[model samples]
Target: MTQINITRVLKGKYTIMIVLIIGIILYNIMNDENLTFTENIIGRMIYTYSLFRNVVSLTNYEEIEKFRSNDCSIYKNLIFGFSNKNELGIIVEHSIGYGENQEWSILDEYESLEIENIMGNRHWIEIDESGELTDGISMDMNRELHKDEVVVNFIVSKKLLENNNKLKQNLIRPVKCSTKKLCSNLYFDESKVKVVYENDNISTINKDDKAESPGIVIYVHGGGFVFGDMNTYEKVLQKHAIQLGKLNKPSIIVYIGYRKSPKWKYPIPLEDVIASISWIHSNAERLGLNPNKLVVLGDSAGGSLATSSIASCLSIKDQSKRRNNNVLSKRFHNYCKWVDHVKFLGLIYPALCQKCVTNSKLKNYKFGFLTLSSLLWFEKQYQSKYIESYFDWRSQPLLAPANILRKFPKTSIVLMKSDILYDEGRLMYETLLKLKVNAKLRIFSGFHGIYGSSWSSGGSNALEFINSEISEIMNQNN
Candidate 1:
């Protein structure tokens, strides 16, 4: 080879070596045990910028426009990554703004006005009738009003959801249950069923199909408050329901489809939970549900919501006693009565406290890649003032006052030893116990998503513990 070609090759090899060394150094710094919060934030920023740069480099503007198209299902697939193995047929119903008919807009007048000015001199100035803000920007008007309005009645088969390794790897994926004889899609409303006996005659009815008053379990799934949907957790919930049924304790599991953050922030998810519980309470008699036997179960971010919702209910009840009446607070005070029916709460590897992230026990606890930067990113999307008011108990239930903690119902918390939030869960459980609240803590050995992943044996154990507690509560109520 010529000397000139050899020199060029040598320079290229040295350049590659330098890049690799820099990458290794950055990785080590990011994972450093003694890294401060500021350092962590900087590391996360660099990591995010690198990822964005790579993505932009790979896709051209034309391809980006195509991906942005409203008709393109790429965004849906990207967000909801579950697979439909077989032709699993299911029906979904969509409604707008609770019971009222309301035309929803994606961008408000402010955003629309801004975008209109951007396309002032452009030749392609078209505003679609179906809430398309721009050519490629669109929004689901129905979802904008409220997510609970969108309901699904479908049966998930065990065979259809039989452990797909590929699907499990993806954090976000669609899960569909097969429409075979094993399961049937069923819908139940207040009109379909009615309470067989009055509240005074609770024990008089037989434990048969007609007389049995099934307990209701409202499940809230977890996905860091941003990702996840009913489709992702349908199988897991169905399995829990079937298992509960086998114990001769029939129960209806209602999977809550709460709105995610960035679009709907803070108290919005909690509001949805309150609304769902209110609807369930109003229709408890017709749904053959024991109004006194409601249980709220949540995992991860859902756990935070569950704790916050319970706390909010207690706060409303206490505030109602005072004479200082505001219209909004009064409405909340009335709504809080419905949540009073909740008898038990179950949390699985829950994110109870944000402050605990930097606690002595958890400062270096690295499991998932959700570092301080990711938390800040989510906060930006959520449009929260948490950065300024970091110790808000609504976001961190562990920081709640003793009175609120004392009012918690019979609680069961399941924590994984390998989880970053393990210490936070332990702290919460301890606080609950200290307040003389009926609480149980179960610790297993695995990472954060183990319950949702292949290591779900721990989840079964957690379920058993929860069921046993529920049974005890039921007997006491009886």
Candidate 2:
């Protein structure tokens, strides 16, 4: 090689070394403010280097093909990794979001779990009046939907959905396949979700059509996006439900479910959350719930979905922006129309950014049960192969534009001072304030999560605070 070429190569090598060295400094240097008093020093240190096995279940290539659409077991044991996997700490490459880059798999009992399709959101085929594929998106405008116990399974249209859009399809390429036939056969396919309903009684039995509309609190559970379910979270779910039931007005508690990852990623799980809106709205009466009076409550990863499940659907009225894929875009537009009725949003320590390495992450990485190491793993499993997926505003709501932030419903955020996500939670609050959204924030002195496990004094305090906040918001809306 020439002398000048050798000089350039040396410069590149030095630059890479400098970047790697800086990343290690950030990873190992702990921030003092995020530390807590004496407790589990070794256990926490162990957790810092280890992750729940299910979080990385989909990272294996062969496993991805075995269980195409099943979520991993919530009980998977923990796995340890000595090397740092922080976005800046260690870099892995050669990525693609779709087609020959499939990185997903399943849980052992995923077959039964797939029954979350209580909405019949599968195999929805739409043909035109002439017995051919419908030209555009069309739902049965005059169809009647039925409710089963606490679940309702409804089929949506396919014609308007097959076409690809830049933002959504980029993360969900397989949503629509190459064959024209495959395009027509695509369904939202949320069959793998685990739905939770507080009541099984059908309102239509003897209900008055003109009776007052009941407010709906749709709760989404958080399991680091790997291991939470309505079943496992029954305690907190009941807590939120029972507290909300005491309101002066009639209310319904709907715990919505979505596909989980490393089995499902990005737009897929989000689509299930969005579909809950459509399904509930369409069958609100039978379910005795009012879609117009929705109040979303989500914790942790659920908080992220609860935020985007509404924000991403916010009025895309400017048709020109997403006109090419009008089906999903139209769903987005329509979701916004009714979304204006959303009364409030309750988020607890929501994971907001994909790439941001905040001070809290650096400080609380060891103490927080959900360490930065585990969080980065969960994020990796949740993201698409596309590099842009990391920066997508839907997943990283903290990075969203001002107008988007302004459109959020009255929101309440809960942050734990010694948690890895504390800084980002505060950032989300500050951003909302800058945009003038009616947002509220609460800071607790606990670690990352308390609700998912045994409810402690901290959990009780947090729930009480949230309950009071909900009561106030409900009173205002009333």
Q: Write candidate 2's Cα lDDT for 373-415 as tens digits.
A: 6678777767655434223576676776677678788888987
lDDT of 1 at 380: 44
Alpha-carbon error at 94 in model 2, in Å? 40
Measured with C-alpha atoms, the lDDT of residue 36 in candidate 2 is 29
Query: Model 1 residue 318 lDDT?
Result: 58
User: Candidate 1 regions off by >4 Å?
Assistant: 1-209, 324-334, 360-373, 386-392, 452-456
Compared with the true structure, model 2 gives a TM-score of 0.60
The CA lDDT of each predicted structure is 0.50, 0.51
State the lDDT of candidate 1 residue by residue for 362-386, as single tens digits: 4433433244444444444333443
User: Model 2: clashing residue pairs?
Assistant: 70-106, 118-153, 119-153, 119-154, 137-160
Query: What value of lDDT does candidate 1 attain over all alpha carbons?
Result: 0.50
- The RMSD of every model to the true structure, in order and in angstroms, is 13.7, 17.8
